[model samples]
Target: MDSLSARSSPPPAATSPFSNPKPVELLKKVIFAWVQETGLPASICVRVHGKSFDLHRSPLISRSGYFKKALRASNAVELHQEFPGGPEAFEMAALFAYGSRLPLDPFNVAALRCAAELLEMTEDHGSGNLCEAADLYLNQVVLQSWDDTLIVLQTCHTLLPMAEELLIVSRCVESLAFMACMEILDPEQKRGRPVLPLRTFSDRPWDPEAVKELAGHDLWIKDLIALPFNFFARIIRSLRRQGMKEKYVSPVVVFYANKWVLSKKTHKFWEQEDGADHAANTNDKVSAILQAIVELLPIRSQDPDRNAEIVPVTFYFALLSMALSLNLSDGIRVNLQHCVACLLHLARVDDFLLPENRVLEDVSFSRELKTMEEIVTIRVAFKSAENAEVVAKLWDLYLCRVAGDPKLGTDRFMQLIHTVPVADRETHDHLYKAINAYLSAHPRLCNEDKARLCSSISCQKLSQEACIQAVLDELMPLRLIIQALFVQQLHTQRALKDCSESFRYMQCGVFSGSIPSSTCQLPKSQSPYDPEETTPVPLEDHLVQRSEHSEVEYESTRFRMQALEQELASLKHSLRRRNPFGQVSDCIGSLRWSSQRKYTNRMLKVFRRMSMLGKSKSKIKQRASASGSLACRSKSLNEMYDC
Candidate 1:
């Protein structure tokens, strides 16, 4: 009865029966067979790299929009299409289009992805597009074993616009970036590790080849820079958005951002002479870069300290570096100044937290000094006397932080302090206190260090006092000396103003080279203190009025004129020597010119170089001393042997 019931159930649905066929499945099989050249006659001929491929037109048109459009516009039996990739890539795409099992491995996945994207194909079995399938395979399977990540990145970069259009490059970039920061697990660690290990920039995957390859692409990185501001911001922002476990997003962002900035700076386009067009273009680029940086800045204000630490130090520094390099307009510059200042502050904090990062040590120091120089320049340009106090505070903060580093010692701290020009009393006092506080905090600082630092303070005080006193002393002495000299000159002028015509004529005749004789007739003045002064009469009246004593009077008047002239010359010389205020003002003007921000920065750089040279010399001297000691020991041993 059971057998009868089973037989009555439509013969168990006739498993694997061919009577009612699946036409679509059968068609796929026929297409795969056609690709292998084992089924229906090929209707369309496709040539890739001079190799003719026999393929079906219906399947190619159905699977690939690129092919559909190409064949629709052509009437030829054979179609010629260009594929930039290898022949193997096209072969994989052709087989993939026919519903054949596409063999995806590390060796061919990237190439297949490129080809699939180029051909605009979709998978036969899955709902996913072929480009997406290749992307998944490349990232999940192939990238794990693939060693040449840079080469793959280069390939993707070459086809950036197309790859981006296909929505496949993102995964490729993410995978590569993940690998760049992936921690290398030990054998034991690997055994207990999760399926996907998490990492950050702290893991520090240092691959020299990767760095070299990235540097090689620096010239072509303009593709990244040319991306619209939103796209560029999205690229950086998305790195951190991937999951909480991934802290490495910032490192790769910084690395690429730095490269992008450097590339744009050195690009041939910006090297052109500035004009209306160039300025407009430059402004556009500056705007784009500024917007991108603003987007990358930390948004959280809950914890100020952690906010900066959230992003790697290099990211902030890269932004700051780019900011300094850009020719931002005054309006933009003013708005972004705070942003730059915050970055510099954050960078210093990072350096403090991670002092062992020798890679960033010199860069941090150079950047810090450059930032100070820029701030000072801007302040000076504004010429706001009130800002001087702010500038002094800033310098104090910088100096305190620098002195806090045990390696720098008190000497370098004092050296930096000496570079500051004389400031107002209040500013100087604040700076002094800041320095003292910094020194007091140093547990290892010795008495000699304290004494030396104290000496720097005392020297500053004494120098400032001396400058003030010099200005005051010169001013007072100059005024007094000029007043005394003017009084003596006033008496002489009164005597001259009171002289009558005959006396003046006798004096003039003797002084004038045209006169043959020194003697002449003269008349005495009524009073030396006369309120009204009169000009001398002509020589005839004088000659006739006092002929008897004319010779004596002429000699006396001539002597008086000579004495007055001598006194007048002395007065002029004295006045010049006594005008100390003018001299001091000129000196102050010269000092301002000499102590400009640019000059001060140059001097600081020169001082740094000299300090480096001095250290090198000291090292050489120590080496020499050690070698001498060894030589002396050898000599003693030889002497002992001889004895």
Candidate 2:
């Protein structure tokens, strides 16, 4: 009975050896206190950047794989391991290994992450992964400032191996891309400028004052140009995908792409085995890089207006440089060469001032060609050899022989004329001779057209007025009336410059249906005591009382002003509506032609001509003629008006 009672008592609650174990926080405190305050014996020594840290061997080996292998490999009193991140980074890493919270601040985070990667300190022991902790600090702290993040990313690119190990490069790119996307979708951001506003990562609304402060510092585009090629490519591609326009992005892309190509081509003399091999290697590399970059770049829109807008003059020069140097694939080379020619064409259209333009500052570009023939050759190549012959014929008939209407090729022609410096005697002589040869080949061209074309092509010794006169004299069977009209219009234009204010007033009167009486008259209150001074009269209420002679003079002036305006309007209309021929076509038709399409099959050809003429004459006002056949009369007054 006593044994059963004793068994039921559970052997007096046997003492548990594991009872009252130290709390984790208290235990860590005690260990740290012992390490910091007490003279505790440390079994290992870690040397970093010539500095030694005396640490416990057990903790070092348990927490770091590096220490474990390093210590096991040697039984010496101290274990010295190589850490690349210097002493400070090693100290931060060591603290992390000691079960202490990491000092993952912005200033030290990048260094610490690099050290962790170098030391293989990536284990998770409830404290956290040091690499991840550093990254979090990077994102939350360092990346809060755009400049800081950009600098870090650029640094990471330079330190390729360390960055890849820590994953800083990719994460930095991601952060920039996200910010770019935010800017793209932000409604308040300006349409063409992707200026990102400053804000915290907490997703707070951007402050107006902060934006104002940032305006002085809004130059991310310039910084973007300085990024490593691959990183720059990714950021630009990502930005474009979010909604940036191709025109805005294409110039920079081309610039950097050309720059990158040039950079890669910079080979050491010893690196190349032979010219052929070097060329082949360069060609292959260029093709690969261009293809990859092209895939990531923004595609130009189908809108011709947007495409036609002028890029920086440097774009053409850069592209031309690429064409002359890099042995790109046939498709890419042809396309790029065509772009170079097209840009030259566009530059001419924009009246690109070569002397003033920055692109001409490049010595390589300026020295590439010394002859006008070279410029013409580039243009001809742009049209392709097969098309060049026919294209020349088309231009001669429409642009030269007719009345000097500027066709699409006009800009390219003008660009060719001005690309050479006036001081370059040899080149200018070559250019002058080339122009004369061109003019002499096309004899049927009108005097005015010849005069205009020669005027556009600058000569070294010949004054512009003298050149025009020489070309005009050389033209065959000049129309005296047309020449007289051209001179008269020139004189009228000179006179109109002086009468600009009056012309403007007259224009306003025409639109308003009444001229303001005050426009031409002095106030009656000049004496400061006139009877009309107290009466505040509205402009519409005012009536003038003057002598008959003064009235007659005023009437004559008004009539003269009206006639001058009419003549100017007619001159402007003529200049604006001329076809490539500089002459209006013979068959002017109306909407009546479309309604009368059901006319007999005999008149189908006539109807088609009428339809074609209707489309051409859409903007011109139709006038009835009293004499001659339809074709003859159309050629007479209409051709005169069209030019």
Candidate 3:
């Protein structure tokens, strides 16, 4: 045979070129000279993805089984179908077939491998084929290095089923998983120890020590962010199988989702800028990414042993927001919603204020409200009082924010308020403020709606200051003001009734001779009620001083009760005569309830102190006067009641 025919002939099966390397430089020079000669033109044409290559059929058929079979029927072949790595990869294969060295690196190795497989360039056709050469380089060089494995795995995204069938993706994932698990389990690895030589395709030099020092335990996590979601999930599963803890795995998952999924430009509910088909396509892609991320997330384990570190509540909210914006599967949406609801107490008011793209104006708050309802129900079921209060307060603040939107209707506003159970709120201060905010914003709301909105607020739960403000509020409905007034009256009446009973009990204790008379004479300057009197009194004189103080408080309470009766009577008459729609500030301005409240509080304090002072002596003459004082106070209370 001629030198060309001998060089191009397939070597014997036992003597592969990979085992005993051949010097092909002279043959390459001869082939180049032959190709340049004008008298000897190329014999065949190969077309791929609109690009054409004219070449001699001898070298192509000898190197590639696919070409050897195709050229049997004709001299020209048209590859109109999609190629594995596009035209660039096929160019490399063609160059390799021509006895030229192929440039193999982590970035292009996976694609070249798939392209070689597509061309059926196996050892059956030649001594050492492109497919075998690519596989050897990938296993020995690419998978052995930390950074190269990631680069090759990323390249595998463009080479789908071919790369998958060649097990290139699985090999890269296994390598990454093993490295990550080692970094987590081995303390030496955690301290920035380089496991393999740091070599990468990029021009930028990486200092493993610096990265380990800066990223600490999360160095592997930071490196894995460039991987596509499908391969990323595979790596995560492999890591889990290797007994890697979820605490280390969760942050990277969250980071990946944030980088790829949440950062995408989502279609707004009201936007039709993109055509329906384009929007639908984008939605489907985003939905797939989101679902994959949710699946890779660690299931919130109830078992303490299995429980790992939790992903941030903010990320869950963000995921849920994105999920809602797209037309996602119900299962994925529900999973995200449940995750958010579980950690709802850790959420902030701004978390619920989802972006405009996610929130439909027609159902502005329905999704959030539904999540809150779940939280409320869970908290109530578990009897988690502290968390219940937290959720309640959070909802109240959120309500205050949304209440100002004139678009928020009464039913929705009321739904938000009532979503939290009545028992969860320790005080109605927040609820009352939220209601006031809603009423102020929607001034055109009819009286019945206003009344219904305010009805959720319990007058009994209002602080004394809030009650006073509510009474003076002109926007308050007439019935609510009356209820506030009635609550105030009940408080005052209870205080007076207790004061009168204490005085009568003490007078009885004295008249029944339960104490000695000698201890009843207290000096006038050392009364316990005097704030400035620091001098200590003997136990008996303290008792007599308490008796005197109680008698004085009884007289004061009796007079206050009479004043309250007159004011209440006046308020009732005013309500009956005045227009029901009139402002309450006009009627409440004349009442001195602020001062009356102060005095009533002071009298109650005196009564409480007198009770703790112990039953003791008063002289018979003083006791008779005390009895007369009690009788006169009791008579005044009865007369006021009758009036």
Candidate whose lDDT is highest: 3
TM-score of 1: 0.38
Q: What is the lDDT of candidate 3?
A: 0.63
lDDT by residue for model 1 (610-632), tens = 23333333223211211232234
lDDT for each candidate structure? 0.44, 0.45, 0.63
Q: In candidate 3, which residue pairs get closer than 3 Å at backbone N, Cα or C atoms, i.e. clash?
A: none
What are the root-mean-square deviations of the candidates from the true structure over C-alphas?
A: 29.0, 21.2, 12.0
CA displacement after TM-score superposition, residue 13 of candidate 3 (Å) = 39
Candidate 1: where is the Cα deviation over 4 Å? 1-43, 47-88, 95-136, 143-154, 160-162, 173-235, 243-294, 297-326, 329-332, 342-390, 393-425, 428-643
Q: For residue 428, what is the lDDT in candidate 1?
A: 49
| lDDT (tens digit, per residue) of candidate 2 on 178-275 | 66555445566545542322113113221223323332333445456556668888777766766665655554554455444534334333137446
Give the lowest summed-lDDT range of ten residues in model 1.
Answer: 1-10
Error of 3 at 503 (Å): 9.4
Model 3, residue 583: distance off in Å is: 16
Q: Between candidates 1 and 3, name the one with more favorable lDDT.
A: 3
Better of 2 and 3 by TM-score: 3
| Candidate 3's TM-score | 0.68
